[model samples]
Target: MTIVRATFLDTPTGETAMGAELRAATDAALRVVDGTIVERGAWADLGGRHTDDDVLDLRDGLVLPGLVDTHVHYPQVRVTGALGMPLLEWLDAVALPEEARLASPDYARAVAREFIGGLAGAGTTTALVFGSHFATAVDALFDEAQRVGLRVTAGLVVGDRGLPEALLTTPERAYAESIALARRWHQSAGAGSSPRTRYAVTPRFSYGATDALLESCQAVLKDVPGSWFTSHVNESQAEIAAVARLFPDATDYVDTYDRHGLVGASSVLAHNVHPTDRELRLLAGQGATVAHCPTSNAALGSGLFPLRAHVDHGVHVALGSDVGAGTGFSLFKEGLQAYFVQQLLGEAGLPLGPADLLHLATRSGALALGLDDEVGDLSVGKAFDALWLRPAETSPLALALRHADSASEALARTFALAGPADVAGVWVAGEPVKS
Candidate 1:
């Protein structure tokens, strides 16, 4: 057993901040223990706290739960700047073609390394990622995540129809491959002693996946019991119209997935820009999560997400970069985008504030992925996954809110305005993955 301590900030409830200071600081000490955190009257009574472990003092840097990106495409990393088209056209022109390359194991493996490295470097430790249609691509991502000791949930993109032919999976093949991959990687252990990888059932979106294909994906969930289902819903105007045309029998775009048993607690539906009150109510009733990709929505002209409405309705809303369409891997930038998009819609006024943004990036994101209990916070029993930010001498966080130039600057601004940026290191499951 080992004990490492530092100034800690965590959100015990979604609304309150819990801060603690340890007398002796040890850098990344949780990597050694196994078992639960013992409670000691509002504090964790660490039973076997070791005093001799290596120490890492963040020098008062802000250490919060590692950022969680609820939505992103691993294969789209190469097409970051492809612009102008809406979701459907973009998918046809740039996204699908690039994803087609993942059919090669070697190519998939190399891309997986880059994707995970990029996410980690940006302080994202947990992500609900979408891989190419190739099952090998999903496997490669899981393998790379295991190597880096990051907590990742991903799956094969099951677009059996309407996608580029090279990137398509037959309905039967999609089901078989999804099940095979889930059984192999979902909840699989990492290089460490505990399970670090999980699988989600991905159907691309209603437009790309045929009714038969969506059903097959739902069937995989029924078979797997606890498998997660991820898909795009109500992202763009064209996509919405396409879904209505494709599934005329369904009342709306959200219903297409709901009818297919794709809407539920373990499901993550990206976008909801055009969802109706009824759709939002259905999502809330079903305990489904909405991954709000504000940057992507804005970039693709996907319309502003009704964040206030979703929050008022008690729907679980998390922030996602939605890379390629969303533009960056940093959840901090995603938070800033979310804040600005809502402001543009006049739904909320600015100085949207950093604490709220941090909550969305961390706790809210984890909740969306059904991973709130394990990650998203710095509680003693939770996985020791966190990012240490080092602010510039003038307090970069403060400068960010007013004069931010880059995503990193925005993150520093988040810490300054709402929290602090003393990130001297990052730890995943008690192991220091970066410093």
Candidate 2:
């Protein structure tokens, strides 16, 4: 058994529902048995109770829940900051071309290593990754995640139309290949118990699929019990127009997926930046999550996300790096970006507190992925997925945490200034990762 004492912070339930309240332990201690968190409480009590256990002290640093990134692209990791172009044009010029490179099994394996390394290095313990087009490449990604012991939900980016010729998959082929990949890795490399990996049905977006293709994806979801579904939604005007053009009979863009049975409790749609009121209501009622990608939205010149609008409607919200277009994999950057976006929106934005920002980076994402019962907060029953943060000694965040009068002030300062490099240690399911 091991014991770690630090200044710990988490929001047990979502911050929005908890009145933006923070659950803090100024001098917190955690007890781990095997790979599970056996106890978490005030350091004074747990430290005295577990006097014989090996101890790790984080005197000045903060212990935060391991971050969960609900949306990111595996193949586009190298294409970040292909600037000055909007969404569709960037996909045509930069994104798709880089994704096409993953057709090589050898190249895919190499990219998978960098991708998995990037996640852990940035303190991301759980993620919903966008997988490569090729089954061999997707396999490499799952293999790398298993080897790293990272929790991931990912799948092939399937579509049959309105994409580069090299990336297209026929409906029959899409189903067969996706099911085959699921069979191989869906149960944490098919290990049969509490596996860290799960499969998702990821149709690239509505514009890329016909009814035939999307129906096939729906079939995969039905075939795999406890599986997930995800795809892009109203991220850009041009893309939304394209979707409308393709699905003329549908009530709206969200309805396009609803028609195909892809919008539900198990589904996560990326970038609802342009969802109409009707769409928001539908999403909330259906229990789907929005993988909010603020950096990607801003970088690609997509409009500001009406985050408050979704929250007010009771929709589930989570963070996504949406890398390549999103800039990087650091959930800190994503969290900070969220703050900046809200600030830009002014009063129209959600009145997000420090605890809410941390919740977005950690718990909200887990809840969105339907893994809340297993990971997310420092609650005793959850796995010990956490990070030890040591900001630059003289940096604003570090100095503020040193002098702040209370936990709330320290947390606010850390969110305002800390980055991934500040993460001194990362643990997932009680084991250290990120080298």
Candidate 3:
């Protein structure tokens, strides 16, 4: 058992009258036993009771739940700044070509290490990573995640069309490879237990996947009972127009996946930047979650996310740092950009508060990935997945934090000014993953 003393801030789990309010614990102690938080209370009480237990003092800064990334591409880490091109053009000019290089096992292993390091260094403990087109590369990703102990749900990215020939796979081969990868990495423990690394049936996007390939993706999900599903959605007008032309019978971009029964509670579709009202309704009714990749949307010149419309329609929303096009792995940047996007939309935007930003970055992502029961907040029953923000004393963030007027203001400033450099420490399941 270990006891950690810190000033922790997390969003409340479940519904409450205090809606979107942050749960703050100043000078508090958490008793963690085998990675799970067993006890939490004021330090004065828990400290006196557990006098002999090992203590990890983190009072030098604020502790928050380890950030959760709902959508990020594993192969695109090296191409983050290949910007100025729109979505499809960016994929052709930079992203896809880089992704194809992962076919080399040695290259994949090296990229996997750098990708995992980038995530942990940026304070993300749990992520829904879009895996590579190559099965061996996806295996390398799971291997690195397992070695590092980060919670990752990733799988072989399958597409039968609209991509380079090297990245394409037949439907039968896609099914076989996906099932094989899922069998290997989807569960480290016995069946029904949540493993640190799981599988997600990723179908690149509607324009890239044919009806036959998507059917195989659905079959993979059916075979693996608890595996996840993720894909790109209405991201840019040009991409949407291409998808519309490909699937003439489909009503919209969401219909292309929904027609194949791919949208559901287990599905996480990224970048619904131009989702129609009907698409939003279908997503909400099916209990699917949308990953709002704010930075990528702006960097690719995609339109502002319809956050207010999604909220009004009861669609679940989570933040994703769509790295490569997204700028970086920092959730702080994503949250800040989300705030900026909403502000730029005027009445069409949902004015977000500090609590809202925090919730979206952490708890909202956990809920989206169906890991809320295990690792979202600093609640007693959750895993001790957290990050400590201890900016250098001479830095502007530190000086701003020292003179902040309130906890909310401090949190706002954190979103506004903090970056990966400010993340002094990060832990996942009671194990220190970064320092």
Task: Compute each candidate's TM-score over C-alphas.
Answer: 0.86, 0.97, 0.98
Q: Ranking by lDDT, best first?
A: 3, 2, 1
Off by over 4 Å in 3: 14-19, 188-194
TM-score of 2: 0.97
lDDT over C-alpha atoms for residue 105 of model 3: 99
User: lDDT for model 3, on a 0 to 1 scale?
Assistant: 0.92
Clashes of each: 11, 0, 1
Q: Model 1 reaches what TM-score against the true structure?
A: 0.86
lDDT of 1 by residue, 1-435 (tens): 444444444454562111211122223333335422222121133423444544444534456678899899999888887778788888888988888998899988988998898788778889989877887788789888888988888888888667777877788998888878877886642233227777788988888778898889889888875678888998878888888898889999889999988899998899898888989999999999899898898888888788777766668888787887878787877877877876687734323455567777888778887777888776656777788766666764534534765434444366435322334566787677776
Cα RMSD, each candidate? 5.2, 1.6, 1.7
Give a tens-digit lDDT track for model 2, residues 1-435: 988889888888743422556888877888988868889888899889888999978766898999999999999888888888899999999999999899999999999999998899889999999998899999899989988889989998998998889999999999999988898878744544338888999999989999999999999999988899999999999999989989999899999899989999999999999989999999999999999999999999989999889988888899999998998999888888898898899989876778888889888988899888988888888899988888878877888888888777888888777877888888998898854
- Which is better, 1 or 3, measured by TM-score? 3
Query: How close to the true structure is residue 388 of candidate 1, measured as C-alpha lDDT?
Result: 73
Worst 10 residues of 1 by lDDT: 16-25
RMSD of model 2, in Å? 1.6
Q: Please give, for residues 1-435, the per-residue lDDT of candidate 3 as tens digits.
A: 899999998896642111488888889999999999999999999999999989999999899999999999999999999878999999999999999999999999999999999999999999999999999999899989988889999999999999999999999999999988887888743564247988999999999989999999999999998899999999999999999999999999999999898999999999999988999999999999999999999999999999999988889999999987899999999999999999999999889899889999999999999999998799989999999999999988999999998888889999998988999999999999987
